[model samples]
Target: MYQLLKQIVTTGIVTEPAPHADSALRQLEQRLSETILKHLGRALAIRHVDAGSCNGCELEIHATNSPYYNLEALGIKFVASPRHADLLLVTGPVSRNMEQALRRTYDATPEPKLVVAIGDCGCTGGVFGESYASCGRVANVIPVDVAVPGCPPPPTAIMQGILTAISARRS
Candidate 1:
């Protein structure tokens, strides 16, 4: 016990240093907040749908909601129901089974809604193209306002896609 305490004392606090505040990211957050307010006049409510994915894009989306990206600070938040969402953030290749559900979700969202297709799968269907079991890209199932193409796009890219969708809506 004495030796263990001595070793702990010697090791002290061994941890990664806190991340530094990023001015660029802060600016982006501010811009997104303002743009969302201008276009929607309220916080952007998003509904995330996973048609059929290997979960890679979902992880990046989760990271976007984390403190580093601080998506909520940008006045964007995920909601449980499509009825309350201003945007639909769809991920993965559209599977045959989810086609009806995806369509229904899109239909449920009110007018002036936006859709951002995340990852290459959502954009171009990735490895699962149009097939008996797959419906190819998200656009195959529903209209997509913005397509963010990447095997699994980073959080910043996701944010950019959302911003693009909002900006395009005004024009």
Candidate 2:
């Protein structure tokens, strides 16, 4: 009875997160937006690669463009070819079978391209690091410009990482 009452009251009274906190997030997003516009005026085309993930991180990565977040508003887009990619968003721990593929993918992208390794697995191998078939993290194959650490980092975090990379380039 008491538990039910508490649940009802909490649900009734608790609103969204703090308004100021939401404002802070908005400011961060604006900062990223301004940075992208200032440094990379052109729309950024991203190519995604999965070395050997369970696909958890991939879902969140894909969600960046969907309606809830709508990363396209930030002038971001996904491309099919690595050659045309302005940035590479790589997920999962490197696998023995995928080592060459990973290298080939990275090589296909033109120089001055940024690499974003997402998820704890992509960053540091997570649970799959100890496997004999695993080749450690994404860094084991190519240099990564940004690291978004989480079991599966939120789309906002991934966006920030990409925006940061874009801002680093003067051209």
Q: Report the number of the highest-lDDT candidate.
A: 1
lDDT of 1 by residue, 18-43 (tens): 23222321112232344554766347
| Predicted candidate 2 versus true structure: per-residue lDDT over 1-98, tens digit per residue | 99999987776642222111122112122323455445553688899999998899989988786666677766778899999987888899988898
TM for every model, in the order presented, reads 0.76, 0.74
**What 10-residue stretch in candidate 1 is worst by lDDT?**
20-29
Tell me model 1's lDDT, rounded to 2 decimals: 0.78
Tell me each candidate's RMSD, in Å, in order: 7.6, 9.3
Worst 10 residues of 2 by lDDT: 18-27
Best by TM-score: 1
Model 1 residue 100 distance off true place after TM-score fit, in angstroms: 0.5
